[model samples]
Target: MREHLEGVRLGGEMEEPRIRRAAPYRRIAELREDEEWVKVMGVVVEKKDSEIVLDDGSGLLTVFSDKEGMFEEIGVGSQIRVFGRPMLSVGKEMKAEIVQKVDGLDFELYWKVMEEVKRLEEEIR
Candidate 1:
């Protein structure tokens, strides 16, 4: 009985460490806009070769990077936090600079959104 109890305690201890590691990312959504730099958790909704589109619940913003190598591991459905100036393009499209992806969480949200968009497009056809 003592051995079983110790095993259960060990399992609980392992889970707590993982939860604590993720706690910092949970606070990403609380960032304020007035701050010079803001960290936001967002899903990568679009990836067009060199460009990436991140959707942080509010809206989608485009990120353009000259270093395409940085984007090799990023997929359409990845979650990322961008650190840079937000600007409006000539076409009034909003975008961010110096974007970085969040690790561990699979880009599942991006895949889900992409599937929905594809379904809608098919219906329109």
Candidate 2:
């Protein structure tokens, strides 16, 4: 009885769960066959009814969405951030879960910040 409550509080509370995190950002060139999820930011190089092609400078990736009109508002030349799972196919492809347009971003500064964040994350690990 007492042993069962050793890690539990008097009010039956337990440790709070860690906050769930979204996918990590990755350059298109860094995507691999084994990658499950990723976040990517790129310019829209092409746009179709259900898919859009993103170019992050390193490479191009195709992002498909099942929702109708997902790519309707997104046009070529627009910068966007995409959260999705990579496709299992041979080519560079992903199934988009969320798409967000990024306006007036400084690419050079963003890259620098992202690099620093990655370095910190690696150090923590």
Candidate 3:
């Protein structure tokens, strides 16, 4: 028998699903306006009090967060990955939800792998 979540209330309603969709990994230049979630890997070229400028070779993008401790371990020249929601109202930027350091990623190899993954996904569709 499976457990039921009928009594569960999300924001006083029981309609919310328990799963979150995965954010797609994308290069800075390929991000689309319609995408709700996105993941990007880049070098932290510049970091401020609330934002960091990331360069993924394809382009430069600003990733910001108002939440505390989000940029604690991040520093200039640090290679990191950011998962966030894009905010295109002003310029090329995103409201970061998660930021993680990537210690030894080889961008050349990573790019090749992503290209192959995209090709496979296209074939499946």
lDDT of 3 by residue, 46-71 (tens): 98989999999999999999898788
Off by over 4 Å in 3: 1-18
My TM-score estimates for the predictions, one after another, are: 0.45, 0.79, 0.84
Per-model lDDT:
0.55, 0.87, 0.90
TM-score of 3: 0.84
Q: 2 or 3: which has the higher TM-score?
A: 3
Better of 2 and 3 by lDDT: 3
What pairs collide in candidate 1?
A: 77-107, 77-110
For candidate 1, report its TM-score.
0.45
Tens digits of lDDT, candidate 1, 34-106: 3443334577788877777776665556666666565677897787766643344232132344566676655
Q: Estimate candidate 3's alpha-carbon lDDT, on a 0 to 1 scale.
A: 0.90
Please provide, for model 2 over 1-125, each residue's C-alpha lDDT reduced to its tens digit, 9 standing for 90 to 100: 88877887566668999775778889888887676778999999998889999998889999999988777778999999998888847689999988999967876688789989999999999
How many Å off is the CA of 91 in candidate 3? 1.0
